[model samples]
Target chain A: MDAATPQLRVKRLRAVLQSVRPFSSPKIELEQYHTAADLAARILLLAQSHGDVAGRTVVDLGCGTAMLAIAARACGAGVVIGVDTDADALADAASNLRALEMEDGVDLVHSEVGSFCRSVAKRPRPAGVHTVITNPPFGTRTAGADVAFLEAAAALQPQVIYSLHKTSTRAFLLGRAEEMGYHAEAVAEMAFPLPKAYAFHRKSEGSVAVDLLRLTREPPAAATAAAAAAAGE
Target chain B: MRLVTQNLLTCQVKACMDTAATPDGGFLSYPLKVVPDAGGLKQVASPFDEGVAKSILPRLDWAALRKTAAELGVAALPEEVPAGAESDAGFLRSVYALVFDIHLEEGNLLCPHCGRAYPVRKGVPNMLLRDDEM
Candidate 1:
């Protein structure tokens, strides 16, 4: 049982994350879609491989049921904050933490993502949000909900943000990321399981194509330097 | 929430963000005071990772940490982050304790500016604002 291997680690992580309780009542309006444990392990492992998770301050925006938050903490994120608009989901997150015996492992905040960003922006210290990992609402129900989460993460000015979005919106989200000072790269594609939880969901079991996007904050100096180089050329 | 998280949280009330002046002339939303209930505080022993502590040290608001520590009855922190504090194990341990160790399981995070109280139950602070507050 050599956990040093990434494969073994992911297996263990997925097993632990599986213990997390899902939403008792999924909110369609909020797009309370759960990120499966296997997928969450893969994402967190990838982030850890890239020096993003371990000992980094990670914020989980719209952290429904805190699946990703728990994963991040388990993967050695120095500080993990799970912010969500829903109280019931946060209650579940708390129980998940206690169940995992990680009662103090993650911090849970109850706030809309937009306001949470605004409030954190006013901290006396410069922004300390190092990385943000979120499986935001795909905005299927509420128009622009996905982009709203992106905007909130960008406002924190973290070094990197990893978000899941419908693959169909790749071009549009890439454009938005550019406009928001991030260099967006679609890192991985996943078939996100859409377990039939809503009345509108027709299929008993279904999946959707999603892209895992890594939005790196382009350093202002580098951007300026590149622009200068382009101008000189 | 741990002080590490608290160090980053401010009052999210929309009116508070309008930059209303407090008596001391600080922005109303800058620091939300911690009001811990009796026997609400818990100190958990977490592994001290030097890398994490160093990365977070510079980003911390020392004044806010000091104020919160005083409220929680922790020992006084130095007025400033000592020179070369990153390599100072003792200093880092203290910082880790203040930031990551202390948890308010049940309490209220009262906003200094708007006098709004966000309740903390089961160690999760509810920062959700009402429509009127928003």
Candidate 2:
């Protein structure tokens, strides 16, 4: 495979990502949406270019079917942990990993995103998660569910987080990010195609404008102080 | 799941979520006991990468990994990571194999403090807590 060009690399990555199995029976309440391979590939490629994916420990909160998790591994992330509340989604994720010969690169954990983050926070040692990439529920069913996912990702203390959110909520999430001590910006805009997976949908297909929001953790107080001292010298 | 992932997991029970440690000790929730069913433990060799191993070394809880490795009877690890272990090729290979190559296909991760069992099936651990437990 002559993936000398970035375009070729993305093409190859997308080809593999297309095989990731999506939700068998997506639940409306959980907002289990299948992330298109193209979008996932683009997001992961962007993260990789930013030095956030390769050799970095990544956590995919709300990892339905492990789309982003698998992509992160494909991008050379050292360790990828996919946490989902739904066991069936995780089953599909496992199968996807096996079919792609990527089973060893990622681990699936059956837990709600918030619960998993809480556990990581309580551990005596840091979980060493460096990046988090998630396409969370868009908050149509449950109010604040999207923010809840963001909160969980932040709790993991990752260096950077790439999350998908409705572009409409950009202002609110950016504010929340600031409150949480993260410097956030929308890095990419993409349309998330929604195939009719639920009964409530009026149309057979729809698309929502989403932003690939990147949240970088600000330097800790101690690190900032040390940097300031060094600069003074 | 891989032992590398296990090294990061902890009991998610509500009680366990609020505190860093049990009153008795600071390490109760983590390094969950790995109890593999008959023929559940397996290994698939992966290419060793010294850079990746060294990068992950700082994130690992050496004590927890040693305890978990000991419990599973997989490999022996020193009480402490030796000096310059990061640069030592032999040390990196063993650690990489132990953490990344081993897999728990079917088992239970029992929380030492709460006795709550998180079942591992088909290489994925179900860490979800029941509503009441949550």
Name model 2 segments beyond 4 Å from true: A1-3, A219-233, B17-25
Model 1: TM-score, first chain: 0.91
- Cα deviation of A158 in candidate 2 (Å)? 0.8
Clashing pairs in 2: none
Residue pairs whose backbone atoms clash in candidate 1: none
Candidate 1 residue lDDT tens string, B10-91: 8888878776554564555656798989988888988888998998998888888898888777869889888999999998
lDDT of 2 by residue, A1-233 (tens): 23356667778888999888779989888999999988898888878767788888989888899899999998888888998988888888888888988888888988888888878777876778889999999998999999999998888888888899999999999999888779888777889999888788899999999998889876323342233222121
Instruction: For candidate 2, please provide the TM-score of chain A on its own.
Output: 0.90
Candidate 1, A1-233: lDDT as tens digits: 13376667777889999998889888988999889998898888777766788889999999999999999999888889999999888888888888998778789998889899977876544677889999999999999999999999999999999999999999999999999999888777888998888888888989999988889876323343232222121
Categorize the docking of model 1: medium
